[model samples]
Target: MKIDLSFKIAVLLVPIILFDTLAYAGIIPEKKRIIFKGDEQQQVLLIANTNDYPILMQTWIDNGNTQNVPSATVSPFIITPPMSSLAAGEIKGLRIIYNKQKTLPNDKESAFWINLYEVPPTSKENKLVDNVTVAMNTQIKLFYRPTPLANKPEEKTLVTQLSCYGKAHNLEITVSCKNPTPYYISLSNIELNLNNHTYHNETQLDMMVPPFSDNSYRINVDSTNVPQQVNVEYSFVDDKGDVHGVKSTIRID
Candidate 1:
């Protein structure tokens, strides 16, 4: 009877011990997903959870190619409920920004991966824990062509010129359009790339030029830091809703 009792207790304790070991080793459950908004801009948000445990996460963009170089790197922009204890049934949101210009294989469809890591707990004295990670996949589509215009008016021809200046940490660009036609134009779908990283904005400009006249616009590249290369792309729509695109590149020393 005594032997049987001891055997049963050992079996029950074994499973419990294994579970606790896994949990303590940062083997907790986790999930992640990528989301985007439809606009001329390139940005995404990463949503994740630790299933009731506090965790430390790190993220990167894989661009889904075997080229061995990631298309983008995320600088942990925000951490919600920045506390050590991530109570049970808690959700966390992480914002990730990608400059479309820095990504490789420009004008082609690419894949990206967001990796999340669960940081292990450590002790004050000889505290060391193992780390575990989970990943989410996404598809990045690049639109090289301009969208068609809407509401046709009168036919016209226009000439545009662009100039750029580069510094160690930022860029300045200017665009001038000569309107020889009778109608106005709107510029949209503006994208910029630096050092293989890309940046985009959704704001479109309504360029007004008197009949047989000209118009000019300026864009500033006040990036947080300087990049190795810079490229700019944009599109315009005529009064008749006809759309067109232009691309330019610059190398920084």
Candidate 2:
């Protein structure tokens, strides 16, 4: 029996190519999530094999001021045989704990991340080889909302104040009309201004606010692509179809 040299090489390369593709796409087995202990702390978990193939996993905080800091206080949880190598499909856990004192700033409310990088396995001399190390990681977002000290106010008169909290993005403004009168009210138009750029839209409402009761509408502001600013203008129509407007501003850091 004679085998063509090119055919033999192709047959041998198929499995290696497939495995490399799978590892690059992060199809390898792994699990990740943010574990909350109480109100002020949480943990990021990463688990992968580190046997004959060593996987480098990088972890960092994505949202807060403490971004890109390596996992120090948090350690990789591992279980291996005394003298054996970590085989494929084996499991290991890497946990990174985020403490409030370190991860958050004053008045900060939430934290989010993009993704974690899995450094390919390298030799002790840091040379790349045909290793079978897998890259599997995830992003964990932790939110911290402290309990309010005072009693909450009623929502019947719903007073919502919209403002830009961070760097503003695509910015647009909308206003909802509420009629608390017995007769029907009509709204004619709505307008918005930010940093001298004007945005206006026309709308009509055929609604009635019952006696001693109220009707409500909403104002939508889309700031996805707008530059960061401190002022936003909202113009709208009242129940009498008359033009009315309000100016609101927020600080962005």
Candidate 3:
């Protein structure tokens, strides 16, 4: 196992609010994803309750692939506060810690899920209200970067494989994120430069491409103008608190 350079990753948490005829719940966060690594082994997520009454939120980390499923055995690498209660219009910090001493693969990145289940103040007693009056639990991907034992993959690898071309039938242009390498690619801000016009995704999708995966998004712009190139913005957090942002471009022609 080899320790690589450090980076500070930024996860974008968005705002969410729930409204029902009988109840209202809110959990507003700055970002959706969280990165845990190196000396900065912990990240604090600020959660705000915009509701009028108190709400009990259960916090935990689960494997990234598995969803809201409950497991008898818990994950040992990440630790989250068991639970928290927020009053009306109150905000609280949920500290997530990555155990430094724990043994994890140093060759690649591992992913997990962070869950915040908002239990209605009267959930236990009024179970029937769950159908229409309760807010769904919030969850996002939590990534862990293990020290790389070998040469790290480059950002150009993702950029080089991207493409934008129109389909023969519908002429809808599809932008692709093709990953030929073994490393997973977390991608964002994929902008297409066509003829003289440019377009980009507004909201972050938190899209990731597994090794050798073909991922594509359809651009709603005019496909008649052949795409010239694409500008991509990718980022990750190092073991230190530094956040590395890489901007790379790929020519479609």
Give the number of the best model, judged by lDDT.
3
Worst 10 residues of 1 by lDDT: 140-149
Which prediction has more favorable TM-score, 2 or 3? 3
Per-model lDDT:
0.39, 0.36, 0.56
TM-scores, one per candidate: 0.28, 0.31, 0.56
50-169 per-residue lDDT for model 3 (tens digits): 566788888777765433454542554554567788887666677788776665555556667777678657756577564555655677667665545244545555445543332322
- Model 2 agreement with the true structure over 44-155: per-residue lDDT tens digits: 3323342235445454445423334443323222111112223443443344444444443223223244245555545655445545644444443333323331122321
Report the alpha-carbon TM-score of model 3 versus the true structure. 0.56
> Residue 135 lDDT in model 3?
51
Residue lDDT tens for model 1, 1-253:
1123443344344436534322333322222223222223443332324344444544344433333333244322222222233333333344344444454232222223443334533445434445344432222212221122222243222424323333342355444445444333345555667546665643432343333455544455655565555676656654333467767654444
Total backbone collisions for each predicted model:
16, 14, 15
Compare candidates 1 and 2 on TM-score and give the better one: 2
The C-alpha RMSD of each candidate to the native structure, in angstroms, is 20.1, 18.3, 8.5
